[model samples]
Target chain A: MPTDKFQRWVNDLQKAQPVHPDQTKQTILSAMHPKRRKWPWIVSAIAVAMIIFGVSAATLPPVQEVLAKVPVIGKLFQSAELTIVANAGKLQGVNRTQSDNGVTIKLKSAYVQGRTIGVRGVVSGIDDHATTSGRNIVYHLASKSNHLHMNKASWNLQKDHAYTFELVGNVDHLASGRKIQVPLVFTKMFGKKINLRFNLELKAGKPVKVAFKGQTSVSGYRIKVLSAENFDGGIGSLRLRVTKPVNERDYLFGISNIHINGSQKDYGLGALGKHKSTKQSGIYEFQTVALPKKISSLTFNAEVADWSKPEIYALSELPNQLKVPNRAAMYQFQPASLHDNQLEFNFTLSGTTSSDRVLQNDDLPYLMYLQLADTKREHAIVDEYDTKGIGKNRIAPILYWVESSHHFMARVDLSETPFKDKTLDELELVVPSAFEKTRKLPTITIHNQK
Target chain B: MDDIILAMHGDLPALEHLLLENADYLERTAYLYLSNDTDVQDAISDTVLQAIRGIKKLQKPQFFKTWLTKILIRQCYRRYSKRRHDPILIEELPVVPVAGNELSSEQRLDLLAGLRQLNDANRQALLMHYFNGLSILEIAQITKLSPNTIKSQLLRGKQQLRDWLGDDYFAN
Candidate 1:
C-alpha cells in the first residue's frame, strides 16, 4: 500500500477508536475539579477543623514567626542556588502599601547587592481582563540622585487577585549603606497610571578591584587580560585587549564557561561597555560572575571565528537572494530606498538546511555587520545605539518572524550611522562579515597575585 | 474559540469541554511518541494539567490545538528520554495490536515496525504532517523548528519509510 493509504489507515484506526472515553474524561474532570468527589465529607470536616486550629494557631508567637520567615519572593528564585542568595539578601519587617483607583500595590522588600538592585512586591485588585491580555504592566524606578535601570522584571499571578512581581537591575550610581527615596512609577497599568514611593536603604558590600596583566593566544589572536573587579553581588567585570590582526579580515572573539577558583558553575561572560577598537588592538569589557571573597584564580574558554570578507553590493542589486558562504542560510533583500537621511530596507535570513539553527532576534546583529560605504573606503558600522533602538524617531532594526511567509521580517535602520547623509546612489551596501565556523581555544587559567 | 477565551479566564467547564473535544487527537498524538498505553495516558493527563494551569498564558486562542499538541509532545519526549536509560525486559516491549479493518494485522505490524525504525525527529515530522494532517508551518510551530527543516524532515522521513517498507510504499 502507498503512504497515503497508510495515512488513511491510521486515520481510520483513529476514527474507529472511541474518542472522549468515559474513563479518560472522568480522570481529567476529576483533576480539573477543585475538590475530589470521593471523601468530600471527610475533606470538608478536616478543612473545618484546620480552619479552627489555624485561627487558634495564628495567635501563637512561634507560628507567627514561622509564617513571617516564609520567603515572600520565594517564587522568584526557582533555583536552589538563587534561593540561597535571595534568602541572604531578604529584607525584614518592611511593608509599604499604596492603593489608588481600586488597585493596590504593596512594596514588600528591596535589596541592593553590587550594582544590582532587586525589588519585590505584590499587586492586588487588578482587572482580570487586563491580566488575561498578556500585557506587562509598564513600570520603572526613579530617584533624586540615582537612576535604577531595570534589566529584568517578571510578575506571576499567584492567586485570583494577588500578583507577585520582582524587578532586578543595575543602578547608575548607588552609594553603599545610603538611604535613598525611590519612587516607583507605573507608566501604564492597563491604561491607568500609578506612582508609589518607598524609602529604601541601599546597602551593598564593598567592591574589590584587582589589577592583573596576563596574556593568552588562540588561533593567532593574542588576548591580554587587563584587570578584573568583584562587587558585593556575585557580579563582576573583566577587561581585556586583543591584538589586531594584520590581515584585512578581522576575528570576532567570544568568551564563555568562565570559572572562578575552579568552581563548576559557568560564570557566563557577557560583553560589557562600548565597542572600542584601534588600529593596534581592540579593548573589550565583559560582565562576569564575581569572584568569592578569597578568590585565587580565574579561568575561561575563548572562541575565535574569522570574519567573512566584506562583500559590497550595488544598490541596483536590490531584491536579490544570496546563499551565505560556509553556512546553510539564505539572505534575501527587498527593494531599498533612502528616506530622510536613513537607508531603509527589509531583509530576511532564512535557514536552507535541516540541521541549520534558525537565527533568533538576538543573533541577527552577530550574523553580519552591515554598513553603508561609498567608492572611497569610508563606511559606518551599526553602533550599539542603533542596534538597541534608543534614539527618538529611530527605527532600531525590528526583527520578527512572519508566520504567513514562514521567514523572518527585519527592518534595519541606518539613520544614525556615519553614512546617514550619504545618498543611496553613491553609497554601496557593505556586509563587513557574516559569522563563520568558530573554534574553541583551550581554557586559560590566570592566577591572582595577592 | 469562545470556549478557549472562557477557559483562559479560569472557566473549568469550558476547559474540560475543549479537552474532551480534542481528546482523541491528543491521545493519538501522544501514542505516536510513546508506545506504552500507561505512558500515553500519563502524557495526556500531564498535558491536560499543564494546559489547565497555563491557560491564561496561552496567547493565541485559535492555535489551541497546536498549543495542546506541543505540550503533549514535550511530555511524551520527556518520558521517551527517561525510558531510554531504564532497562526493559523482553516481555515489557509493547505488542502492536494485530486487529485492524483497513489493513491486515501483518501489514499494520509492518507499518508500525517501519515507523519505529525512523529517527525521532523524522518520525515526529511524518506523523504530525501526514497522520495528524498538520501543515508544515504548524508542525514547525509545534516542534519549534523552521518550516524548511520540517519540510526537509518530511521528505527524508518519507524516503526512509519507502526504503524500509518498499519503493512503492510512497507514491511519487
Candidate 2:
C-alpha cells in the first residue's frame, strides 16, 4: 500500500511542474478603450457624493437639466402642493395620485382630526430612484407646545418596512426635502393605543406579600420594583412592571413618571427628544413575579398608592459577581425621620380611544427603569438589589453594575428636582432605527395627563 | 562582468521577454478568476493586448512583474463581471472532475475546486505568492496592500487551505 501511494505521488509532482510558454509584444498591443470603462464609475461616485451632501455638485448637471422632460420624474423634485383642513375638512385633488422624480406618493388618509393636527410630508425624487443612490432626508415639526401623537400603538407592520405617506398642509415649513431613517423603537397596533402608562411608588422599605391584580382593557403589561437609593438626598423612585402580553404594539406604549406624592425634586426634564422620559426598553426582562389573582385578568388601568405595610421580609438579593463586596448596599429609612409622605403619579395610555389589541405576545417583559441620573452630587455609592415581601407589598432593591468591589463608591444626593408626570408617545418607541419605516415625523396632538 | 554589461547596456527586449515568458501564469490567474474557459482566454488575450500598447507607460521596468499582475487581475475582474449572469446551480455545469495534488486527471480538477472558496482578494494574494513565486512585498505592491497585511493574508490563507485539505492530507 505504501509503495502504491509513493508511485501516485511521484506522478503528481512531475505533472505539477510549471509550464512556460512564449509570447510577443505585438500581440499584447491590441485592446485599448480607457474612455468607456472609467466614466461610469466616476459618474456613480459623483451622484453618491452629491446625494450625501445637501448641495448639488458638478458631476450631475445632466440629471437636473434632463429632469424637465420627464413628467413623472419632475414632480417628486421641483415643487410640492400644500393644503390644510380641520377635522372633517376638505382634501383637495382627492384622487390626484402623482409620481415624480423617482418617488410615487399620494394622500391616502381619509381620517381627519377633530383636534389640532400636525403631519409632515417628505419626498425623495428621480436622481435617487433612477439610480440606486441614498438621499439626504430629515423632518421637523412646526408647532411648539404641540404633542406629536399617533392614532394607534401597533400599525400592523413589521420592522424595517417603508410606506410612502403624504400630507398636504398650509404649514409649508414641513415640505422641505429632508430624509430621515425610521426608528426601530416602537410599532403601531390596532385602534388607538399610542404610548405606555406606568405607576410606581418610592416607599421606604419592602412590602410583605405584594399582590398586583387588575384587568387590562387591552392585552398588555408593565414592570414594578422598590427603589432604596434617592438622588443626592431627596430624589428616589420605586420601579415595577406589569408583566403580561408583549408584541410590536407593547413597545409603542410609553410611560411617564407622574409625581412623588409629596417630595418630588422637579428635574426640569420636560422637553421633547430628551432621553429622561419613559424608561421602557425592548432589550431584556426587569425582574417579575405573578401571584394568584381574584380577577381573570388585570386592567393596567388602575394605579393606587397603598403603603399600609411596606416592610415584610428583609431584602435578600441574589449574590452576583457584578455586585460590590462587604459594603451594605440596601439602606433602610427610619419611619421616624419624616412626616407621612406618599408619591402620587397619574399615567395615561392614548391611541384609538385606548381600545386596540392588534398586538398580543405574553413573553417579553414590560419593563420600568429608574436610572440614578446624578450620583456625583452625593458621595456614597448606593448599589443594592434584593426581593423581599410577605403580603400585598414587595420591595426589589436598587441594582447597578458598580465598579469592582474595592473601587466602588456611590453618591446619592439626587434631590435638586423630584419626579413629575411625563408623556410617552409613538415617537418615543421609534426614532432610533436606521430603516425608513419607523420615522417619527412629529405630529401636533398633545397627550393629556389629567 | 555580466552585471556590468546588464547595468550599462540595459536590454529592453530581454525585459519584455521576461514579462511575455510569465504570460502563462497571468493567463492562469485570469482563468481562476473568470471560471469560464472562454472568458479566461478572452481576459488573457486582452491583458496581453493592453500590456503591449502601454509598454512605454511601464517605465519602472523593475515593477514589470507586479504591473503585469495588475493588468491580468483587472482584466479578469472586468471579464468576470461582464460574463457573470448571476451564479447558477452547480448541477447546471457538466460533471467535470476537480483538480487536486494527485496524479490522475480527476486530481487536477479537485485542486481547482479548493481555490473557489477563497474570497477574490485572498485568492489573488495566494496566486501571487505560490504560482508567481512573488515575495510578500511584491504581492503587496500588486494588491495595493501593506507588506504586513500581505503577510497576515498569507498566514490566514495557509490556515484556510489546511482547513479545506483536512489533517490527514497535510500530515504526510
| DockQ per candidate, 2 decimals | 0.05, 0.04
Number of clashes recorded per candidate: 0, 93
True contacts kept of 1: 0.13
lDDT of 1 by residue, B27-64 (tens): 77676777655577667778888998889898889988
In candidate 1, the residue pairs with backbone N, CA or C atoms under 3 Å apart (3 or more residues apart, or in different chains) clash, namely: none
Give Cα-based local distance difference scores for all models.
Answer: 0.55, 0.29
TM-score of 2: 0.24
DockQ-based class of model 2: incorrect
Error of 2 at A177 (Å): 37
Tens digits of lDDT, candidate 2, A258-313:
22222232221111111111122211111112122221221112221111111111
lDDT of 2: 0.29
